[model samples]
Target: MDNPSLFEQLGGERELRTIIDEFVDRVFDDVMIGFFFQRASRERLKAKEYEFAAEHLGGPVTYSGRPIAQAHAAHPIMGGQFMRRLRILEEVLEAHDVSPAVREHWLAHTEGLRAMVTRDSGGRCDPVDAMKRVQERGKE
Candidate 1:
């Protein structure tokens, strides 16, 4: 039998939406990174984040947001900021009691996007390759 996709493992759209809703609120209100989203629409960001996560997690959803690189290009994000966002995500995941496998995959996928989101790649980020992996995630 084929393995269940990550989306299924994550409890489908309803549960995923619940998780994303909380995560987005926390991210938007985060003292360390909330400034980045001061001008952004909370509702729109939530929608896009839901789409993005749904797609990557193997749901039958498409992310309609702009490409990651283009979307984040206007921001002057640093490595520390990126790491802070990851920490926030980690905490959110733990609070939600996300399955270990799903949590690791999601975090790794976000880490892979660091190059596209920030400039401190440490010479290891290849945004192109990362996007390719993201596009291929649900297929596996």
Candidate 2:
């Protein structure tokens, strides 16, 4: 059995970048979250996503700017919003035909960041509820 780290399972930076790109594209189309990205460009967001993935996957830290928590501190996203983003992210992964093992691996790795991200988003979100939604989704 191949017990690869989530980073290895994801095929390293290139594959992670691809996944983030695809996921962000879907986010751009989501009416609820799209507005949040109105002032951002795909390229910039892509770079940010890449940095985030790299950091979480135990790779070199490419994100050297302000911490995510401070950056999104004013965004009023709550548990429901986080759930919505997760749903969209999952949909993108599925649509892109990402392998189930790889998808699950990455999701598991990234799941821990929910509280950090939401809290940084100004505590507008309920971490407990966000965790519940993540658990519920995992059951599907």
Candidate 3:
């Protein structure tokens, strides 16, 4: 028989939910990539995250999130910030004891989105803050 899908091997929706939760928490606590997600809703983010991961891993779910470029439009995201987020996910997977092969598959899926995630790269950043102040005065 063919090998189980990565979604199945990784334990499906339940495990994905756990991973997404931990990933979100870590991202929020991270100095590098937290600002971009500070105003986001945990529930909505988890939903989109689960859908995206599930679909990408060959699960029977469809992702309803905006296209990558559209989703990140006008954001001051950079390659380093994207890599920071990627590192958080990698750590989460390692914490979950994901096998080496599975981790490679998941990471490969992530690397595929670098273009969209780093579309706004190549800007100089403030060393003192290391963050973009893209938040409007009243967007809070």
Candidate 4:
């Protein structure tokens, strides 16, 4: 048999939705990054997240939302916020018992979208430094 796609490896749509639901919920509630989403629609966020992940994982869905950069253009997301969101995703994946392969692929894909989502280069910034940068940038 041919190898299953990452979507199939993830138990397909229902399972992926479950994971995304929890992930989005945590993101909306996260102290570090929650404010960014305060004015956004939770359901819309979940739906768009599902489409994005589904398409990337080789499912039969395509993302129909705004481009990543356009979608985030208004948000002054800092490296700290981006990294916090990534950590939340990692925790959610671990909690859902996602396989290592899927976890790695998902994380890598997310990291690749960082530039489109934020000007901040995230992985290097410790929390204090990231906050400092955010504050400094706000003054510019």
Predicted structure with the largest TM-score when compared to the true one: 4
Task: Kindly list the per-residue Cα lDDT of model 4 for residues 1-140, writing each as its tens digit.
Answer: 39998999999999999999999999999988898898899999999999999999999999999999999989988766788888999999999899999999999999888888776654445586768889999999
- Per-residue accuracy of model 3 over 1-140 as CA lDDT, tens digit each: 38999888998889988998999889888887888887888789888988998998889999999998889876778767777777899999999998887789889888778777675543323433343354443466
Shift of residue 40 alpha carbon in model 3, Å: 1.1
Q: Candidate 3, TM-score vs. the true structure?
A: 0.82
Clash count, one per candidate: 0, 1, 0, 0
* C-alpha lDDT of all candidate models, in order: 0.87, 0.72, 0.82, 0.90
What TM-score would each prediction reach against the true structure? 0.84, 0.69, 0.82, 0.87
> Residues 46-99, candidate 1, lDDT per residue (tens digit)?
899999998999999999999999999999887777877888888988998889
lDDT of 2 by residue, 18-129 (tens): 8888888878778877877788798888888888777766665667657766877777666556666877777877876777876776576555557766644424354567
Candidate 3, which segments miss by more than 4 Å at Cα? 120-140
Ranking by TM-score: 4, 1, 3, 2
User: Clashing residue pairs in candidate 2, if any?
Assistant: 78-125
Q: Clash number for model 2?
A: 1
**Model 1 error, position 129 (Å):** 28
Regions of candidate 2 where Cα sits further than 4 Å from its true position: 1-4, 97-102, 119-140
